[model samples]
Every structure is written in C-alpha cells, then in structure tokens.
Target: MKNILQVVHFPQGAVEDIRFIKSTNMPYAATGDLFISCNTSDIDANNGGYLIARLDKNFLNGIPTSLSWFNVVWAKGYAKAVHPWDVTNQGEVYYVSGESHGYDWSAMYCLNSQGKRRPVSNWRTHWLKNGTEWKGTPASANPFGQIDSVNYSGIVFKITGRCELRSWNMADFSSVQSDGNGGTRKGKWPADFLFNSPCDPQNPSANSPGYTGYSPEACCPVWGLAVLQLIEGIIMYTWE
Candidate 1:
C-alpha cells in the first residue's frame, strides 16, 4: 500500500518553514512534522546569520510529541554549514568559512548531534599571490621591470575542505596598466610604467589630462567593495 502526506504553509519572516513525511510497509501510522531555524542577523539589521529551531513529529492537535532543535551559523562570503550526504545516518554537522583571514584563508568546524562543537582545523591560510597578480587580477607590477603597458597579471586561489571548497580569482575584468589610456602616446604615460593608468602619477597624458586622478604611492586596498560583492555572490551560490 502507498501513503500520502500533506504540508501546510504559514507566513513568518524571511526564512521559510519546512515539513517532513514518512511511510512504512508494516501496519504502522506515519508521522508529519516541521523544523525551523531562527537567529539574529550578522550582515544586516533584518537578515543574515545563524538560526536555531526545532523538529516535532506526530504532533498532537495542540501539543507537540517530539521536539528537537539545531543551531547553525550562517557565515559571510562563501561559507556555510553543511551536512553529509547521508545526514540521517551521519551524526555530525560541519561548517566552513570563506577566505576571510587573508587572500585565501578559510576555516572549518564540526558539531555532533549532541550539539558539542569542536574545531576541525585551524584557520587554513593559502597565499594566492603570483608575482603582481592576485587570483589572475593584475596587482602591483614588478618594481624592477617596467610595468607592461598593455598586459597585466594577477593571482588566484583554490580552497577546499570537507564541508565546502571554492576557487576565486581577483574580481573578473580587473586590470592593471602602465598608462590608463590603453598605453597610448609614448612617454606621455608613467616613466616606470608600473601602475595602472588611473593610478600612474607620472602619466602626463591621461584620459583626463591635467587632472591628477592617479596615486602612485597608494597600494590598492586588498579588501574593497568589489571584494565584498564577490564574496556575497560566492556565499549565496554555495548556500543556496
């Protein structure tokens, strides 16, 4: 014989509610239940962070028979808690975080069904620095060699762990050049040709000539708004 289960929906907040169903071959009654997770936001006033909720099976009309709650810390960037494929059998849960320690650093933690948490590993650091580029995005050029007028280079990072792993290069389309104007008009650009045109203080013929938009001494901030955007996208994709 076959069994059917029905699910009901209710409006709450940002997160949605979940329901479960089960069937058996023996002369036994199936059960229905719900699980929920709730918590405070870490990124915004109304969103993002960890949550804890409960699961009740074969709930009475007004009373719950079985209840259990679990906590999860939703991390920023490409980091989140994950369960093993056979989660029903695996009594442990794991969580991971993105490269927040450094250019390519990540962390992991484990929790048993009993809710005892422990560090799986220390913060794992991976240097994605390759010459002047970071994750394939042209960073600072070699001070010894004249920065390429038309070409650039950077480094990328590939991170992996038990719960999650990802490969991230510098923001796509980011470039570094000797002269911002595509290296046009010789000598009009930087004498060292080591900085992006917009950042080349020595560039005399700039896209906006006479305007000093370049900062030769300023090193690009490793963590910028662009980096945050990339990290957000990664986190969403990984968790979703």
Candidate 2:
C-alpha cells in the first residue's frame, strides 16, 4: 500500500467501515476497480458521511502510487451501505438503526451519485425521478446494480452468520413478496464485517489527534481488516 493509501480521513471525521465497490455501466461493466466506500464517524465539524476513495490503479500496487477521493454523502446519522457501490452507483444502504449503532436510530436513506436521496412517503412509498415519482422503487436502490433484467432487486446473504437470504426489492426496502412472492418480512442479517482502509486514530482518551471529534463508540480507533490487493481477485492481508 502507498503512503497516500495508508491513513486517510473522511473530511473532519474518522472512517467506520470500508468496502471496494465496482462499476456497473457499459464499457466498464466487465471491468471493476477496487474503490473504498467509507462510513464516517463524528469528529469536530464532521458528523457523518460516506466518501469514496480512489487510486491511479483500479487495484492496489504496494510500492507504486497513493490514494485519492471521489464523491461523498453527508449526514449526521449513520450513512452506511450494505455493499460497496463506489463505482457501481447503484445500491441501497441501511442507516443508523439502534440495533447497529447502539444509541442512534434514524430513517434508512437511499441516494445516488449526485447526492440526491430517494424520496419516500413514509416507508411504504418511494418517489422515482421519472415515471411514477411516487410509486415504485428506483434502480439505484439495488446494491448489485440490477437483478434478472431488474435494477432494484437481488438476494444478499451474510458472510458469516445464520443464513437468511431473500429476494430484496428496493421498493419498500423489504423482501416480503409483494406480488404473491412473499412480501417483505423481518429480515435482519449479521456477519463479521472486516474493514481494510485508512482512518483517524483516537488517543488514550478515544478522541482524534486533538480530541476534536465524537467517537462512534467507546472504542477509539476501529481496526480490523487491512489487506493489499495484489491481483484482480487475490488479496494479501496485513492484520494490524
């Protein structure tokens, strides 16, 4: 990893989780790069946000270049996605649920690269950009881009947990088959998520370098996964 990629921040905050997102459009559809989808932690002026990390090479080359940044999302609530849509630009993320953030609880926000959030009339109705702006779920809701000729649809499974996979449609943010399939149900998935990216570190007091930020949790610096991508699909780790 290059020095630039070593330790980076999300504006005036720290990073919570990191995932490499790929592209989903035409020419770059078949080719995907390793981009960082970082969840931000409150620190000083920075509260919550999601920033994309960039590099000269799609993947990482230990001793070559550094890392840069791309589009970002800002919100005081936990603005995190279930999957990395860095370049894909299509997917949905679950937000600051008390179940996940311990104390904070807010509405689930779904947005696009332009930073425009999916407008929902409560939780049962979503407004689209075109057509019926107050009817169905938009394509940007699906983290996997599209599924079976459909955009806001796919089945996701936990990496390591009690398997509970289901066909997800962004329409109402549920898997309960709406059209006799099953209708959205109580689907709560869990897994040991590993984040490998640079972030702000807290001192013994669990604050930023200058005690100028809010710690997401009592735990100061969040350190878990840190691996180097040697090949397109091969990953090498440096567990710190």
Which lDDT value does model 2 have at 133?
Answer: 21
Model 1 backbone overlap count = 11
Give each model a TM-score.
Answer: 0.30, 0.30
User: lDDT value for candidate 1?
Assistant: 0.30
lDDT of 1 by residue, 92-163 (tens): 333343323234433333444554443222222212223222111121223333323213221112212111
| lDDT string, candidate 2, 97-178, tens digits | 1112323222233334333443432232233333332222344342323322231221111111111121122232222233
lDDT of 1 at 207: 23
Clashes (backbone N, CA, C under 3 Å), per candidate, total 11, 11
Instruction: Please report, in order, the local distance difference test score of every candidate based on alpha carbons.
Output: 0.30, 0.32
